[model samples]
Target: MEDRRRLLKALAACAMPGVAGTALATPASAQPWPVKPIRMVVPFPAGSSPDLIARLLTEKLAAALGQAVVVENRPGAGGNIGTGMVARAAPDGYTLLLTINGPLVTAPTLSRHLGYDPVRQLAPVSLVATSPNVLVVDARLPVHDVREFVALARSRPGVLNYGSVGNGSAAHLAMEQLKAAAGIDLQHIPYPGFAQITTAMVGGQVQAGFMVPVIAMPLVTAGKLRIIAVTTSGRTSLLPAVPTVAESGYPGFEAISWQAVLAPAGTPAPVIDRLYRELVAIIGSEDVRAKMRAQYFVPAGTAPQSLRQTMASEKVRWDKVIRAAGVQPE
Candidate 1:
């Protein structure tokens, strides 16, 4: 109360003609929100899919907000490191998070030591984009499709290894679910990020894994990697030629990966609302949608309530997958 009175007095004194230049500088509390550059934290390594998308989106967001929006990579712990950072950040709108499903929905069930509860600490803004993970193998593996790969894995058991960013990542859960469905066994290799996974696959450190289309397609095109099936129930336009795992042999199989914007829980409703509105507009724009689609992403400008529901449903879906794969919480 006293601070408020001081601010009013100072502001009023500034209005006086002769005192305008002499009055104390406006207090930070009196300044409008976004008075400075806003930091959009991406909890993944640079050049990762989320980083690519964040770079694309923050450019427009900065212009829209009339403030610079800088994307900072806080990669590690399958996105938990950066996610926990944002979860613990001050709820002042200056710090924001753009992340994927790992730290949001799956980690609670997959990781024994996950340090943050996304449900309790983060406020959903909107789901930014959605994409299916593509099942890809090193070109040397010689498996043509999901059936061939599963057969090989079933025969080889734990001999075949796959890589993912970390536990609770889309690749991790997707492969585990596929393994359980196919009754095959493959060893899991966790890397720090997809870039490392891609490198490892190219180097033949691992045999097969799931990847975003944007990252998998280039190598697939170059003959370094062979993409067989997508994790979606149906094929995506980015890889329309690629059949889905469900279409191959397994039924009712899906593992869709997505990105969403969020603020720390207890952030002002106005800030969340404004961010949501701006994100929806930017994502819904034809040009932005075109770019996202070209990159194999489908823009999902859902309402905050809708995103919350997505998180809830995904949590239920992955929980069962985790347990079925015998992934005990650490």
Candidate 2:
């Protein structure tokens, strides 16, 4: 009986460890993930489109997560500086990136020495929004529609010049795609930003180029510029009368600027899942939708996998466009 009692005591001690091990493996939800403030890095200037969207969404995300979500603008090197910062950040879900396709897709192909590989370094959380680019010409130009503009460009060849934010920018790529499809020769005049591009276009320094509706519509309405076509699959709500590039002639011409959220690679799956759910809810809310529409943006709260696929596909598409456009990085 003494020996049997000794064996029972040993078995009980072993069983206690198993029970403790199970407790230690408790689900991640029970753990306080974001016990403190979270930082959302926007790889653009403070008042830029990406920054504005980040500020809008962070307010709602903070409320949902019960923590402060701060927007830090670390703009430089065409958004690479902020992007690389997030890519190298700890994968504890404390730091997030709210960026556009430029850094993730085009810049990689344009720049030979980009510090971070977006697909390899960042885990996609969600696609926040997408906005179409409008092909607007100077009011003084004689073109009334896309066909007319193409004809005029063909007739003038390299004499007509178009402006873009810079080489390999979305505007630049869109125009390049257009040039390839329409088989016209137009000189590309790269500027520092959209403001400069718009200024040049309005001043008749350049003939035409692609621009977002928010910037181009005001000028178009003011009789400074004329939108020949929109570069999306469908017409934008902001300009219902404007035909899409596809509708104008080309079949598969779709160029759009998009914004998405991402976390450092190896971020805990539970945290990423939680963030995605909150982001989807926030994006679907009426207030967010209204605000997005007001800014001429189409709100798109897509799955993480969707964003990954989009990044992959865009990288391939832009590679071809950039090569065709003959845009070399500085």
Best model number under TM-score: 1
Query: How would you encode candidate 2's per-residue C-alpha lDDT over 30-70 as one tens digit per residue?
Result: 65889989999997666667887999999999999999999
Q: In model 2, what lDDT does residue 299 have?
A: 94
| TM-score between model 1 and native | 0.91
Alpha-carbon RMSD, each predicted model? 5.2, 4.3
Q: TM-score of predicted model 2?
A: 0.82
Off by over 4 Å in 2: 1-31, 151-161, 203-206, 324-330
Clashes of each: 1, 0
lDDT of 1 by residue, 143-182 (tens): 8999899889988988988999888899999999998889
